[model samples]
Target: MTSFRQSDRLRNVRYDVRGPILTEAMRLEAEGHDVLRLNLGNMHPFGLEARPEIVDAVAAGLAPAQAYSDSRGIPEAREAVAEHYRRCGIDDVSADDVFLGNGVSELITLTLQALVNPGDEILVPAPDYPTWTGAVNLTGGVPVHYLADEANGWNPSIEDIESKVTPRTRALVMINPNNPTGAVYSEETVRGIADIARRHDLILLSDEIYEELVFGDARHHHAARTAGDDVLCLTFGGLSKAYRVCGYRAGWVVATGPLHRAADLLEGVTLLSNMRVCPNVSGQYAIPVALGAGAPGSPLPADIVDPDGSLERRLALTADALNAIPGVTCVPPRGALYCFPRIDREMFGVADDEAFVLDLLHTEHILVTHGTGFNWPEPDHFRIVCLPDEHVLTRAVASIGDYLARRRR
Candidate 1:
């Protein structure tokens, strides 16, 4: 018998968000242990649900969805996505520019596969949503990590990004309301990145999955708007996070800023889309209602979209609780469903963050991912999902505080 192995393309890929830690969590679950999973931004399990209108839309479309639609997506959903962007101030878009996918995850893979050649280099944030790095690797592209300035509210360092560009660099990827860090990019930062892409002739890939999840004054600047008419930009968004429909697998990528310049690339993407047949048909039904109900002039019902502002409240409470602990500090998340806290490694005698996470899981039955899993260069950080209610979140943070207390040197 031959020993089978994964393709060499997977050699450099890593998606530790659901890697060994999740495996350990499942193992513990099999043993009848209750494991609190704080690793992924999965919301439904925590009671965040899709709007009834969106649900009804999908349910009603089930019969029609039995047949495959166009390769790009169902017409109504694509137009809805394009209109959603037009309302957000990206004016020149239309349904023809939209390509719907199973989810942003699949779109990421498709986009990378279409754009990357063997040695192409893609600039990705140091602590990005790991899928970006993993997808780039899977497409045989080199993911160059550009450090986001932690002291400066976790914004991408413009200087660092500019310095990393080379002849081989093909694109720049930015994740606003960044996962694992929860830092929303400022308007100036977004424009600055756009400027870099414009000058370097590199494609701009903006992941704005958490666009509507911003807290307080932290606004999400659309890269397509900032990239304007010269630089080509691809904006990725979905119903997974803000819509609380993770399992629906509905997402889209909109091509903006000089489509003519990206004709070849878009052609490749379309080719791949054709190969996949089409995105989930019933899931695509949710997009039109989801966007229409949440339009600028019209707002989604409170109960459907974070009624009572509990999401913000939970995030604030979790950050405060984590900061209250000795030798631990959390940069308050301005947006998104996570808090990436930095621990004093020397004070805790900790070197490997993955080991620390595993220990915490075994000792406390809590599961959180290591920072390195998101491609953070250091091991002093870890991400926790803030989807749990205030009471559950407080208890979870306290349990983490207690675990840290015992590990302190």
Candidate 2:
């Protein structure tokens, strides 16, 4: 028998969010251990259910979904996506500019496969969601990590980004209400990144998946809107995080900025979209309903999680609990469903974060992703999903605190 090897394209590919630690967690659960998985933004597993409207919409469309639709998506869902972007302040967008896929995950992959040839350079933020890194590598592109200013509310350092830019750089990827960090980009930050893309003639790929999940006064300024009609920009959004509809796998990407410049990339996207036939039909049904219900003027709250307590309340409670632990300092995330907390490395005698995460799983039955998992160039940080309720977060953080205290002793 021959030993099989992975494709050469996979040499740099990684999806650490569900990497080795999660595999071990599953093994433990199979052996009857109760594992509290704080690894990813999977709200359903943590008491939050999908919105009732989304459920109904998908069920209603199941019959019609039996047949193939357009490669892009159904007309109504695409129209809804166009309008959603128009409302977000992006101009000149129409249904024709929208492309739907199984998820932002798939759409991003399609875009990368189209945009990057071997050795093409793309700038990705450090501590990225990992999807960007994985896709870039799979597409044979080189992903250059630009460090975000951790002390400056996790904002991407414009100087760092510009310094890293080279003639070979093809694009810049930005994740607002960032995964892991949950730091909402300020308007200045958004415009600054847009300015970089515009000046450098680089395509901007903005992942705004958590656009509606902003907490308190922190706002999510759509990056494409800030880039205007000058730079070639692509904005992505979906019903996963905010709607708690991860399983639906419904996501859309809109090409914005100068239409002429994006013609080639758009053509590439069309080819890939055609290859896939179309995105999931039942999932497309939820797009119109989800976007329509999220209209700006609506007075009703849209959160499907924590009906008893508001999203703001839950977010605040979770951040407070995590910060209360000794040697654990977390920036109160202004948005998104996670909080990446920094631990005192010396105090815990921790060097390898992945090993530390495994130890925590065995000792406390709690599972979390190491910072390195998200490409955070360090071993002292870890991300926790705040989807779990306040009580659960409190308990989880306490367990971490206890574990650290014992290590210090």
Candidate 3:
């Protein structure tokens, strides 16, 4: 008998948040242990409700969704996506240029498979959404970690990006209103990255899923719009985060700039999209309504904004609670439902972030992802999802504070 083995692609793919810790957390919860799940960015359990209009739209389209739609996506959804980008100042994008998938997660894999060749390199931010690194690795591409300067509000450092680019570097991945860090890229930073991509003739992959979730005065600058004709850009967005519709799995990518330069790449992407035979049809049906309802100047149903909206309240609670913790300094998240706080190792007497996170989990029943999970080299940080309720987050932070105090003692 021959022994079987997993592929090398699975080697670097440990999901620290949902891998072992979450399994234990789930088991503990099953056995009725009081575990505060601050790990994943899931919102459903936190009272974030889907818009009723979106629900109605999905229900109304059930008949059509029962049949297969276009491989790229239903025409209406694609059009709505194009319009959504147009509203963001991205010009000349048509529905034909949009490709929909199960989620931004699915579309990212497809894009990487289409664009990346074996051993090719792509620039990704340290402390990024781990999926980007995983996708690059799975596609047989090397992911180069570029710094998003913590000193600079976690914005991608243009100088660092330029230094990392090599002859084999094919693209740069930018997660605006970045996951974990929740730092919204400023217009200057966006333009700087766009300029770098243009200079090096690299594809720009902008993940803007949290575009609509910006907190007071913080703006999400669309990198694709900033790049213009100089560089080929693909902006990926979805209804998951902002709309509280992660289960819908509706996501789309828009190809902006000169199509001729990326004709082969787009052709490959289209082939991948066709291979999937379209995203969930019911989810596709809801895209137009989701985009339209959420669009500025469009009449959003009252309930969508009623009771102060779960996300707004959640952000406030998280910001307030995280700020109160000793040796845990977090930048007020400008967007997204996360806060990545830097842990003062000296103050806490913690050896590394993974150890700190594990200690917190075991001692406080609070789960979190260490900075290393986001590909950060140092282990003095961790990310906590702000989706939990005010009381829960407050208690969780308090527990962390207690843990830190004990470590110091």
Candidate 4:
């Protein structure tokens, strides 16, 4: 019998957000624990439904999808994606440059695998989406953490980025309307990052999956639009968040600007796409309808929207409630469906973020991911999904407050 050993690449990866804690939470819930799950940002589980038009289109195309389509993607879906980017002010992108896959998760991995050489470095945000770090590591590339300044509303610091770059740095990742913190970068910030990319000749990987979920008065600048032809950019987006179709597993990556230099990288993606054959074909069929002109009626329920049909009211409700809790102070989220709050370690006698989360789960029956889960260097924070009903969120926060008060005693 042969002894099997785990790969070294897998050894360094730690996805604490969805790892042991989530697993234990699920197990406890299966046994009838009343767990208010605020860990994952997935919208489907919180009652966000897919657009009716999208559903109808996917149903219509199901039979045809039984056969293999183009490796890049179904022609119509790729065309729709290309047009979507054009509308978003990214010029010179075409269907030929689009590669569809099973969610942005698959596309991110494919892009990293294609571009990274062993010991190459990619600039990723500290307190970033863990998958960015994991993907870079899996490809034998090092992920250098660049600080997103919390003092400046969680914006990426240009000086911090410049200080981190080395000859080995080959790419920079931009998660606008970032995960966990939910801070949307301004146009100035985007341009600054783009300038750095141009100066260093690094590929810009913009993960804009939450582009349509901007809340309050915040505006999201498409990074590729500002970066122009000097820098090669790959913008990744999909139907997961905005369209509320996570199960569809539909995502596309668009290559823009100086794509000629990336011929080998593009070919690698093509080969990888061919190996998978195609993304979920049913999901591909729905892209046109989802990205097309608005559906006749509002896809969301009235309660889900404010009178202005914006998510601002809900955002405020969650932010205010979280801030009201002792030992918890969340910077108001501008976009995306999360509020990452810094927990006061001294106030609650909480030694670390994971310990705080574990205590909350055991006592309050609520689940949240620790800061370390998102590659945050310190244990002073935790992320909360803001999709729960206003009343439910209020109760959850109050429960956390009660736990804090008890701990202080």
Judging by lDDT against the true structure, name the best candidate.
1
- Give one digit per residue, the lDDT tens place, for model 4 in 1-409: 9999999889767778788888878888998998999887777787767767788999999999998888888988898888778877888788999999899999999989989999999999988989999999999999999988888999989999999999999999999979978899999999999999999999999999988888767888988899998899999998888787888899989998998898989999998888888787888887887887244453332223233543555567777987888777888989888888887878777677887788789888899899988998888888888887677887888887788889888
Of 1 and 4, which scores higher on TM-score? 1
Error of 3 at 252 (Å): 0.6
Model 4: worst 10 consecutive residues (lDDT sum): 298-307
Please give the RMSD of candidate 1 to the true structure: 1.6
Better of 3 and 4 by lDDT: 4
TM-score of 4: 0.95
TM-scores of the models, in the order given = 0.98, 0.96, 0.95, 0.95
Candidate 1 per-residue lDDT over residues 25-143, each given as its tens digit: 99999999999999888888998877787899999999999999999999999999998899788997999999999999999999999999998999999999899999999998899
In order, what lDDT does every prediction score?
0.92, 0.87, 0.85, 0.85
Which candidate leads in TM-score? 1
Sort the candidates on TM-score, descending order. Answer: 1, 2, 4, 3
Question: Model 1: how far is 95 from its true place, Å?
Answer: 0.2
Q: Given candidate 1, what's the lDDT at residue 74? A: 96
Per-candidate total of colliding backbone pairs: 0, 0, 0, 0
1 versus 2: better lDDT goes to? 1
